[model samples]
Target: MKQCWLDIRAAEGLKSVLCQEAIHRGFDAIVADDPADLAGLPPTVSRVLLPGKELPDAFGDADLVIVDPVQHGEPGRLAARHPGVRFGAHVDVTDADSLAVACASVTRDPVTVLRFADPTNIPLEIVLAAAADAHGLIVTTVERAADAPVFLGVLEHGPDGVMLAPSAPGEAGRLKDAVERRSPDLELTELTVTAITHAGMGERACVDTCTYLARDEGILVGSRAKALVLCVSETHPLPYMPTRPFRVNAGAIMSYTLADGEHTRYLSELRAGGTVLAVGADGRSRPVVVGRVKIETRPLLSIDAVAEGGEAVNVIVQDDWHVRILGPGGAVLNSTALQPGDRILGYLPRRERHVGYPIDELCYEQ
Candidate 1:
């Protein structure tokens, strides 16, 4: 998990409220400019003192102190003088020279706070690469809490932590939530096909995503919000057209597909930049961004399946051999070839949905 450090140095008026919110949200640390701000904070959060150019003679209740190496003496000497508080290095990378300094600090410092002068993440990437073998925590300072996810995903192994000066109390919680965004592995159930029927012409959605989905991966679609089936991507070979590895011929516009672990959205609600869960036949899943959604009138086919637990699921998709669904062990079963007694991979959500969000209530969908 990426650590979140709430910087409360500028929010002097709302310091108390922000600090309490940070503690409630389980922030890893709280950074303040003055040692006095760290006095009343508990040990649940690491109290961090990020002083100005001048080093303070005493660090009151701060568990860690971040300082510029050039402004203060060597961190080693300072640690020896003040053994109670942990010392960290802060580096501002503006040029090649400062980038080199930042890289070196990340390798040795127990905690390294980096602030890049520009918007590009190349400097942070290079520093991260330099610290590949180092056993230290690298925290990048982001301008806003919303930018934490981008910096946290840099080079796939982003900064070990992110520090942000939130504008309000709720921003800290949002930062924590963003850093903790991860798709959970689903326990997919084998759904035996009970019926297959041809439906009249309807608008079918082809979800075009920004990611190249794997052969075993696709989106889950169904007529009801409580159940979904794995609709394979366009990675397989087609008879007349070339494969578009980033697309899935999902289903009718009214069908529900998983937006994440806990939410579902109608096919019509998806748009560019929206997210959908790409699930693999093995039950592993990840969130993928929708680049575009193509809806066209096509002959529709409806499939009804039932799980061992007596839960029924239905999916309405384009009635064509080229459009496919995933079976056990990633078996690509063409929609036109599917018959009664066929088994396919599917997921059964435990709760009903209200406007895309999951909620427990009495609900039924025919």
Candidate 2:
């Protein structure tokens, strides 16, 4: 992988710097001066934009970055120093320590969250948004703010469980009380809210635009963890939109979800336990399959994907109508009822070095 850095200053300068960083690695110099500059950086490399303001210490260790403080995410200690680099919507992720402390207390084996919290512990919202969108979590925003309450994302399921953004802050307490007052499965953690929006932010251009994007990508920001949150892109693409991905109760989100184009290509191989999220303005759907769909999250098919630890690696073992994924240790992680025409996660296990099933019509680099 060619690590790089981008500097977004003036539109003209941005184009040049983005091109440079896409090709090299260096310190603060990017400045988002215009739309052209903002669009200068290459879309491939992991992006890290400077907030042009306050940044936290967590970003200090980034390998490649793009500077565009005007970006969304947040301002912190690390961002302050890396002036010009733009890592907007991708900031503010569940710190590995927090996630470890949170999830380890729950999962059977209890892996260390820190291990997953590398600078690339990816925003939980982004992952979730992608998943939810895949599962057909359609978009129909309330015309009025007072419309029937919509679940922001996370919900209190049990102890050390995922949190959904409450419509009102006090609603968290209400939800907490409801869980404590009614259910008795596990302890209740605080409600967490994901920021996933793209309504005219960046490129939407209007409310219709925002809805269009969500209809296309479920929630803009999400993660690949057991649960996915749909929230706005923290350090959004540009212009800025307020999106939010809710923290789903672990296991609350079963099946799969898809956002945008690439994730939707393959709907046939999904097992019943799959989900397909659709969060885009074209909520009704146009259904244009642009690329081939591959089920492996840990994409080993492409050298580029492998180097980036792109997707989870899973193998396809079909037994007539069913598909089973054998873990590296030779155990079935999960199975689903998804059938042809259904959208499911591209199931990939950690052990098998499988390439991927190909879609006949799409333009796949593979």
Q: Which candidate number maximizes TM-score?
A: 1
Q: Give candidate 2's error at residue 166 in angstroms.
A: 36
Clash statistics: count for each candidate: 0, 137
What does candidate 2's lDDT look like per residue over 1-366, in tens digits? 111123333234235533453344331223232333334344444333333454444444343332221243222333466674323222222464444332322222111011123333243333333333232111111112222122222221111221222233233333333223221111111112111121221111000122122212322111221122221211123134343222111111112223322242123322332333332222222221212223322211100012022432111221111122112222222223322222222222122111232234333122
Off by over 4 Å in 1: 80-85, 238-241, 360-363
At residue 248, give the lDDT of candidate 1.
99
lDDT winner among the candidates? 1
Q: Total backbone clashes of model 1?
A: 0
Cα TM-score per model: 0.91, 0.16
The C-alpha RMSD of each candidate to the native structure, in angstroms, is 2.3, 25.1
Model 2's TM-score against the true structure: 0.16
